[model samples]
Target: MSETSDAAKAAQSVEAEYASAEQPPALDTDAEDVGLMAVPATAAGLPATAQGHFAVVNANGTLARGFGVVSSSRLALGQYQVIFIQPVTRSAYTATIGLTGSVGASPPGEIAVVGRAGNANGVFVQTWNSAGAPADRAFHLHVSS
Candidate 1:
């Protein structure tokens, strides 16, 4: 009886192994880049015909997924570019970029931007200026990079 149970378990294990072997190997979702978020900043001091800029404050040096907007009310996934224009406002609200992956852990490293701005816990800021204040703009993060 005990031998029969052991055989059954062995058979099940073999079946699972076969099933997995038949399918393509799973991707390495454990990669540090996955889901990312972006927020809007102000466009103050820029000329009426000027475009603003965007900035990111990465406190933990995590690799953000991506950045963009949603047309619908649902918080669905969307893709945003690395640049945008912002409204003319005095105060600016720094956006937060969150990173998620397989283990869902933030990568331990310094922050960098398009071959510039390399520092830990620093702000990756991009702006369009018309003189005194900068124009408002939107931006997205790069993860697969």
Candidate 2:
């Protein structure tokens, strides 16, 4: 058989196999499926149990878009850490991080710089007061409702 005819026969065989194969079920948002999951409703300012949350807030308390998480349940009464993967440009002394969302009538949770590295010293320090301007730092937050 000629190469052209052989190629056509191969293509036809492949197409026939695909045509006889069962198709995948349609995506159902209401139900969970492979590679898909439902997002549970959660209170504001709480991270989802399944996924971590991310945000970028300015010194003036301005939060960038795509900030926050969806938790399946309310945040427990405990401490949570906000690690800065990409530390802000502002000095840690001047930088402040806090949580904002529906936390009943009480004020939002308070977060302070608990651990950080000094830009000049390059040494990790445990500080309660906000200080330094490290490139990467994390804050420890106390959440109480």
Candidate 3:
């Protein structure tokens, strides 16, 4: 048989097989599959620590968007302070180098997070280049307790 005719026969076979295939149980797969995922019925058995606050800060320490964040400040160069509406002194602090927008990858750097010395609601963040010198870099902060 000619190549064109042979290709046409294969295409028709595929079409017939697909037409005989069964449809999934649901049309909206994401919504239907969500019910199959394991979700805790309650938080009673989980660890006490839970994400309570988060913030995305610009290199200049401007608040981008966040939950329970009051304000953000660029203290000096790579140092920043993020304040939340509630006290977070006892919460676990975490930070990572990031950008205020999702357009590009953030500069590779090191970040550290800690509770502010005198402010119960403040978190201290510091970013440093790979060489360890402080440098201005946007970051994301998370607080859990």
User: What is the C-alpha lDDT profile of model 3 across 34-88, one tens digit per residue?
Assistant: 8787465445554344546799999998999999899999999899999999889
Better of 2 and 3 by TM-score: 3
Query: Candidate 3, residue 92: CA error in Å?
Result: 0.7
TM-score against truth, every candidate: 0.18, 0.24, 0.65
Candidate 3 segments exceeding 4 Å error = 1-51
Show model 2 residue runs off by greater than 4 Å.
23-51, 56-61, 64-145
Q: Which residue pairs collide, candidate 2?
A: none
In order, how many clashes per candidate?
10, 0, 0
Model 1, range 6-54, lDDT digits (tens) per residue? 9999999999999888666656763433333222434655344434343
Models sorted by lDDT, best on top? 3, 2, 1
Q: List the residue pairs that clash in candidate 1.
A: 43-136, 52-135, 52-136, 53-137, 84-137, 84-138, 85-136, 85-137, 86-136, 86-137
TM-score, prediction 1: 0.18
TM-score of 3: 0.65
Error of 1 at 145 (Å): 29
Per-residue error (Å), model 3, residue 48: 10
